[model samples]
Target: MKYFCLRLLLQSVSWNAPLRTACSSQTLELKRMKLPSTFQESSKRFVHQVPATEFVAFTRSFHGTTMGALALTSEERFHEPFELVMPGVTFVQYGSIEEAKRTIRKGKTAAVFVEPVQGEGGIYTATKDFLQALRTFCDDAGALLVFDEV
Candidate 1:
């Protein structure tokens, strides 16, 4: 393969990994599912009694095609098919700090998912101010800040 990161392309296989170990997609799935869910579950189960079931995602940002991820996406095409199964997700204009503030609530927001550089809708990069504001919002709301680097 060309490289591990480009494995999805199935071009070539590079040798001499940082560590000699086997890998699988399950590893990535477990890692991905763990981080975001942990904050929500821990807060509701152990710390805060409020259930942060809602999420804040950027409009026009494409997270994925999966049910949960598709719900977070702003595109209507992907969500139209699985509208009933998709969870509720709040969307704010990308890079709009003020809009995000209005959408994210302390007891309601479970997590804020964003792609620093959006690729699907367009190649739009998040502003430093927007990211910094998100950090503060997550901390104050006791939510997790998840960056989808895909």
Candidate 2:
């Protein structure tokens, strides 16, 4: 009776056949690559060659799907409402540090994803004060500050 019950329990659990097949066919390869110990350490040495726009799109997709909507810049390009592609993402104008602060304070933002240097968005760069203010605001609000450095 115990054996039968155990078999039934196992059968009730759903199995991912594709995942199992892929795992069985693939040979795991472990490769070592050097990475900085911390974000500060990495910032000092590394400047990603990949355009920040690419990272922005990737970030949008990731956050949009995984975490529902996101707090984004108010730039026209990012003004699209939540839909099939960008489910819950909303773009709010991040014109100034004060404006950003107000928006974040008002909303239950999961994270504030921004590019320090706007690549496609007129190549504008965030000032030191602005960046610092954002960091502080996010810290205070208990929201994540995601910098799309790429």
Candidate 3:
């Protein structure tokens, strides 16, 4: 198609016409192009034990830490080295359809957590298709879709 445009330009046509045609073609090409997602990393989870070990605390296990709740905390450094985390939590790559499918298929998963806009993971929003695929996977595995909205 580009070659055809060049041929038309070389013929006895007005230069303005060919220039407009080339510009419109370029716009169409640009529209066809797609850019990759900027954010594509898993959110980290950190767990901590309670500080108080009193008689009541032993059973109840009250906790103390500078670290805030995991749902809305935007800083990864606050939970650096992610200590004593849960064993079964699977953090797949953001926007990774294959990894999400595999993790969901493991059959023991309790919940599939996701954020529509990953505020901590560089403010990355997932594609609709990716989210749909995850929804399907979670449904098949009988897992809950925990949308961790931040």
Candidate 4:
């Protein structure tokens, strides 16, 4: 009876075949999208009531399928159909610290999302220096740094 119940429970949880990152990575994306307000309310980073709504994403990077993730994505082929209303996002050139420096802003940008190894987007990898720069940028800008490793 226990084995039958366990099997039934497992079957009840329908898992997606494509983009299984939905289980974990998407949660990080959601947090990235919504944590600004929390930070504002708590007065942890900044005292302003208005939360920073802007986000930074890498060009040609794939985060996940959540609404914010869809917005962060650069490929039209992946998210054009859904067209879900999402938060503001700026797409910086992938692996280019120059573009990221230009895009991230203090008191406005909320977070920066990146994948160390962009497998779906042609398996490109980020350099150690590039990531280090992003860390500095986020720290100076008071924005969250989210690394999506699926």
Candidate 5:
């Protein structure tokens, strides 16, 4: 009886192959439409070269939708099926220096990601204390502090 019940549950929770296919197609379309020029990519060396392991990006931050960029996104709605796609990214609440400090203290954090002015997370500005704490924590932890100016 347990085996039968488990089989039924598995069947009910099976993957939606069609939806997956459609989403993939749409993603390809979006990529083509949004691909920046090669010149533009080269113009910004900072964006091109940055080692982001467990980057601490804020919720609703906007970097891009490319797999690399998407990994930094904190919103579940934007990064649904791509949860472990980029692996090692740690998401945290936007505000609160205490939270940031605690998170940084976790160790193995490669980078402390933040926005000087968060545009996607509703145009919110980070507090001075929060930014200061982030800088100090990164310095103490030997982690790179990345400020998303975009």
Candidate 6:
């Protein structure tokens, strides 16, 4: 399953020439493999802990993109004072999407860190509309969207 997922992710990248062919052949090889039932079950359980789609997205965004600054939807609990996290990271409690949009625009935040479903902050889940708005805002502003599942 890990190999399958890796193949899919590699295919998504716009690689040139030999790299693309290599990934395609690797993907076909993985598809031909027949794993044991026990291994399949273990793969399913592992994916449940971190969904493949989310994991791929996080890794791609973190490694593939460059960001000048980071804006978090919520406050950092572990890092007191927050500035210790980095030089350009900031936390904002924008009650509305508009406010967040405005802040990100004005502050020129290169990325926004969000948790679709908050587990530590009382199990709060972000609305689909809010997430969508953030997506649009980031797209228009040329900023990366980062999700923190952990």
Against the reference, the lDDT scores of all candidates come to: 0.58, 0.37, 0.37, 0.57, 0.52, 0.38
Residues 3-115, model 2: lDDT tens digits: 00001112222232322232232232221223211332222122232112111112222222121222133333443442444333444444377677766642354455554
Which sections of candidate 6 miss by over 4 Å?
Answer: 1-77, 81-85
lDDT of 6 at 87: 45
TM-score of each: 0.65, 0.45, 0.46, 0.63, 0.61, 0.45
- What candidate 5 gets wrong by more than 4 Å, as runs, is 1-53
Lowest summed lDDT window (length 10), candidate 1: 1-10
Off by over 4 Å in 1: 1-50
For all candidates, the clash counts are 3, 2, 0, 0, 0, 0
Best by TM-score: 1
Candidate 3 residues lying further than 4 Å off, grouped into runs, are: 1-85
Task: State the number of backbone clashes in model 4.
Answer: 0
Candidate 3: the clashing residue pairs are none
- Model 1 quality (TM-score): 0.65
**Model 3, 64-148: lDDT tens per residue?**
2322122112233433333233333344677788777766753465455555445343446556666667656755665544333
Can you list the residue pairs that collide in candidate 1?
Answer: 1-12, 1-13, 2-12
Residue 86, model 2: Cα distance from true site in angstroms: 4.3
As a TM-score, model 4 comes out at 0.63
Superposed on all Cα atoms, the candidates' RMSDs to the truth, in angstroms, are 10.1, 19.9, 20.1, 12.3, 18.8, 14.7
Candidate 2 Cα misplacement greater than 4 A, ranges: 1-88
Candidate 5 overall Cα lDDT vs. reference? 0.52
Quick one: ranking by lDDT, best first?
Answer: 1, 4, 5, 6, 2, 3
